[model samples]
Target: MRDTALGAPNGAALPASDVSAAVGLVGLAGLLAWIAICRSFPEFVGAFDLALPAERLDGPYAALTGLIAAGLPMVLWSVFVDKVHTRDSTGLDWNKRAEGQSTRAISFTKLTGLWATWAIIAAVYCIARWYWEGNYLFAMQILGVAIVPMVVLSVPYILWLDRRMFQPRDGAWHFGAFLLAREPWDREKIIGHWRAWIIKGFFGAFMISILPGGFTQVVNADFGLLASQPGALASALIALLFVIDVQIGTVGYITTMRPLDSHIRSGNPFLAGWLAALLCYPPVNYGLMSAGGLLDYEINAPGWQHWLAGNSMLLSLWGGWMVVLTAVYAWATVAFGLRFSNLTYRGVITNGPYRFTRHPAYVAKNLFWWSASLPFLVTSGGPMEALRNVVALSLVSGIYYWRARTEEAHLLREDAKYREYHAWMAQHGVVTAPLVALGRAIGRGRGEVLQPAE
Candidate 1:
């Protein structure tokens, strides 16, 4: 009952968490409002890069296959793991009735309010995206029929789930955050403090949600090329890479390692961690990335050749390099496995692909993008213009590089292992040693301040 490491028995209420959640809820509402405003005034829509081409709907099949294949197993395994952890010695689910009553501070009203707010945001995004894709009638149906009823219907369900799965019953929270009264030791522990856990869950759900669409991309590309394309070998290799990525993701989340118990926490709450994480994900990217005038496949079927033009040899080479990058990316993920999630450290992974470079995924991913983009293929502009566009498109890689630095900073602060890893990578990494020296030289004017992290 006495105050201890985690918190006091009668722990002071987390007003800060409440405030942060409230701010998040309000910010989401405002984002929805922006979508609505853009929808109502089409002129304003041009100012924001919120539009996605209706034709791009053709999708990528091989990528989709990877996502569906990988995602289902992870979800199933996570559920199985949950069941195993929540069971008692006699094989019963741990009871939380008393714990739910006394230890819980979150009430029904709070949970419902948060969910309802999210419902509004979802409804707005559905309408905005559909409308952007020029499907006005479908957008209307979603608003008039689906969003209205779902918001109304979700209240009771939200209350039930929050109580059963999500509410913090003891000091620890379940992945589903269910209410329980047993010893906190028995509960499934998430990686961070309660606030950070909430943030991680938000992004984790984002990762799961994108799998189907990502898989569809692979399906589209592989099947689309199967009949007409000459480079069957390249296509097959690409498909294999997607499968590897899925496998790596599943491996990371299943570990029982001490550091891998929870994903990493956000070191910088604002720009470095959460904001950067959001920018890295999709739908969100549809809004943030369009402004950079970077090269992307926003054009439809016939028009894509204008931007994506290349001979079969070039295309096959591009596909091959992409697969190689995906392999490196998968290797990184395999080491990270279940610990893999954006903006939070589930744990520091120093083995596997990481020993060769601190950021295998980022490096490989950027190279794959460059290969696929083929900025050398000018679509409609002069050589100078094409070069400028390529440079701009390359900035996308810079964004990931920034993300890598931020992640390093976060891990370095939280785990001394990361600092050691950084030093070792600078001196001994197969791929990173040269870059490390160049980076230090770039900052040579600052005086010899780069010392080893002890």
Candidate 2:
């Protein structure tokens, strides 16, 4: 087995690998130190209110000591464990062969060193927490410290065990094999395109962050409601929504990562602009809402009718806008599908909202954010709320313009048909069509009028 896919590029320095390993070890050490020091002082734990009940502390402390004792042997084994590369298939033979292998031995030593350090740190933290009465705090700290190494060790262990138990054949390593096995529709090119846009969307969100503060200030100032009152509940809800949106966005990203990796492997661009847009926009909107006091859900009023009337109209508008944007996104996705396919040379996705605006999903995203801000305009109870809406709208519009430009550039490269699309849009004025047409007409008549006057 050549393992060509896993091999490093020719002439590449191995120093990069060494440096990464060193950094990982250093980080592990730092985390251990932090846990140890924090656990040492009872007063420190008391200051943070981490102290635990007197009766329950001893058992946990004993358990912590036992864990440390048990982990020490594994740590020592890790230190001695060495890798051997040879034509032989037997595991023990490979280990014996690696007895003098410098690189393999060093790697194992480092791993074992870190494992021992982590185990000891965990023991110290647990002991401190149990005897010192900050049991919960100690447990949280221990769990946090344990997580990274657990992940590092568990993943490899499972993979190795799986290989030995089920597929004992040589040359069976396939990156993203799990994803490929599950989703036959997963294509490499589409994943690459989607990943590229994900990066772009994240950058765009960062840009959007800069302008929302002014919008938030304006909205908060105008609403006249005290921050501690009716505004609080609204603000809290807005924040909660933003958090949910971020969590979902993260889920979407995870769901797509493996596919994107596969797409890159196949030298393709998986262009899912609408999907990326939907994932990225909600966070930006939530952040803006929080900044504008719209998320402060603590404040409530007795006039249910007023609240209903105000919020109802805004919600309706938002819903309508969402529909419109969704339609547009669908159209874009469909229209550009062929071009994206030709460029990245990959899969076809014609389901769900795809029948609508080629990029209906992206459009839905735009509508969602825009509509989300409407409550600030109507229920905000002050001028600041109105200002927040205006500012948010402007920022969103700017983001769309930026996104459109990038999307168009990508389209042009992927498909010549995009040139014609651009020309058509220019002619129709797209979003700014009326203004552009008016300008052209005025420019044409002005020359004649000026010549006649002269």
Candidate 3:
């Protein structure tokens, strides 16, 4: 259940519009960083206490904008790749196929019932979590920022989109009403997504949590990117791109990941999912990164080097990698478009950033984390601390390494084409193949290939 992200010309890695979009995102990041540096917006030091009504709306509003942004590439896909206007892919053009259409029609009653059930569950979870030590205000905020957007705006918009793009001639396809409805679950679904709803809910809630502070960064005249001061430059980069990626990635996740590929074909091993999920959520994502009040929640990478001051040349280096890191994350996720998910193999992507490497997202992310951590050297810190940092950071990187390896193995086993693809990528990748071979050699060729079913 995947859609083609590319209508690329003759196996090209990127289309012309993609280049434009990438350039545009990067330019926007640079400008926003500059503004944050020049203006010192929102005064994050004062936190939400200083936020006005407009600033408060930034997060949820960003979610709206992100969904719109996700649609641009998708709309392009429709026009150029899918050519949906003149032809419907649901086989709706033939009125003679009512039986298949009948099976496809989502029951309005069932959909409404399921949504009501989920709504009640989500509300109860929100409320009970409050009693179980969740913040009441945060719960309310979740309702406003996350849940409300999903129900009132996001869900309906998607349903309408389904009606617009994939409607059957007899109007039998009601799966629009069943947008969040479950398809058939595979074994992998049993464990990796123990908290699927909560994760998605929070994932959606992130825009709500992040956007206002981003606006505040602008408002406070913390103007992001500026000349000369590397410290201010880094702050600006974090202040801006940090917000942008979440919007872009979240939109990608919702548009493609949630609606299109929620059904995981394979679950990652426990270690892979645990470590990745940990980095994605709380204390790790923000606790170590933030310098002040609302600053904590921003997606900005903290010190690649934990011991250094915020205003340091070392962190500036980390910032460069951070940019690469975020860009790669976006590239990989966007390539999947509608197939993005954590700890799951729903589809294989061969174009875009993926053409360069089999594990672009994990590789880029690990590089970013390592650069941020500044391990094995006393570049700005003592040897003991550096050594300790190296060990901890290495562990985190290792998790991703396992993720990449396991992901390949799982994908290869699941799809025969992916197996051929694995062989091809291993032979052809400019940078990744040799690196993978080297890793295999170091592991004594362990995990190099799967055994033939014992």
Candidate 4:
């Protein structure tokens, strides 16, 4: 909280986080308004209904309305209010633009690299059988429709941006040079390039795949009826929070534009970071954490709702607490604005829910799982089963802790600013300070020195 603790290099005060709470708030406001219109004015939506392709604005194309509602406002706020385009981090020098021929050459190479990357991702999608099944099928269909437009649009976009880029031979350019065999390229940059794209390609599809269900649930929710039923209300609220998470999270994945000052400076290159993150998502999670999977914690668990059935007072309190946890999880994503992806460092965020803890989402999510699932409260299973369930759930929480450590390791290595933030959090963070001290004490007792990964 002191100026000394938060000082930037040269002993000056650190600037506030790039993305503001207001940005996400405006987006949330827009989304709520859109949802209101959908629920209240079906005829109005149906009249000029081409954009509202679904009868209820809850289908895939219709779900994209939530993106526009949430994303457009965030974009406007970031550009107009935050002036993100003018940030030094964007690597743009508008006053000293490049010469036309140089810009053209650079754009050509970057385009080559970009196109090749997309082609490879597409090929992978085609070859991967999972992408054609279940929810992923919708993602493939959406990407298929957008591929032509994306390919055509990138040409002009690259050319325009290259003219003002301070250093146009960035990761994409390096990769292009390596592929063309026309010039030497940094192998590290090429690896970084692939790492960033691999994250975008993999997570982007998954995010898209899961978007429609929550959007539909929130839009069609019977709030009036849900209000009287504690269990139903909690589920609805949780679904809405998740809808916010998915909508904002998907925006973060897609809007990695330099002008927005939300470009991935580097992907988290640590293999532990990749492994920890990938294990939590997709086909891996399907096999590893499913009903009969290695980490199945819900063996005989019917969840909080079932256990607390007929007890309205207790159910209300528990449900309310669960909502609070889920809100914190959603707020953590909202805090990132247009820069919340897995396994990448777009920028250091030290605002909103982040000010309280280094990993608000992880902490809140783990707590929510424990509370909502109530691993010890199994119906058919007795003490032994309860103990097994608790142990399994604990291991799942341990995985999240592993993820947090890996992320910290990656960020601490990438940016001096992050190291400062880490140090500051260790001393002053609302939730992180105590945990840091406890960790240090435990390490000392074991005669082990635990330092942030360099």
Tens-digit lDDT track of model 2 for 127-149: 54332342244435445655687
- Model 1 regions lying over 4 Å from their true place: 1-198, 214-240, 243-260, 263-270, 291-315, 445-454
What is the per-residue lDDT of model 1 for residues 156-204, given as tens digits with 9 covering 90 to 100?
5433433444333322334223333322333324333344535533443
Query: Rank order by lDDT, top first?
Result: 4, 3, 1, 2
Stretches > 4 Å off in candidate 3: 1-66, 69-73, 76-81, 84-109, 120-124, 127-199, 206-208, 215-225, 256-280, 283-322, 376-382, 440-454
Evaluate candidate 2 by giving its C-alpha RMSD to the native, one decimal: 20.3
TM-score of 2: 0.30
Model 1 whole-model lDDT (C-alpha atoms): 0.47
Candidate 4 TM-score to native:
0.94
Candidate lDDT (C-alpha), each = 0.47, 0.34, 0.48, 0.86
- Please provide TM-scores, in order, for all candidate models, with all chains considered together: 0.54, 0.30, 0.60, 0.94
Which candidate, 1 or 2, has the higher TM-score?
1
lDDT of 3 by residue, 208-275 (tens): 35544554454353332354655566656555555555445554445432223223344555465446
Best by lDDT: 4
Model 4 lDDT tens row, 111-165: 8889999999999999999999999999999899989999999988999898998
* Cα lDDT, model 1, residue 354: 72
Error of 4 at 334 (Å): 0.5
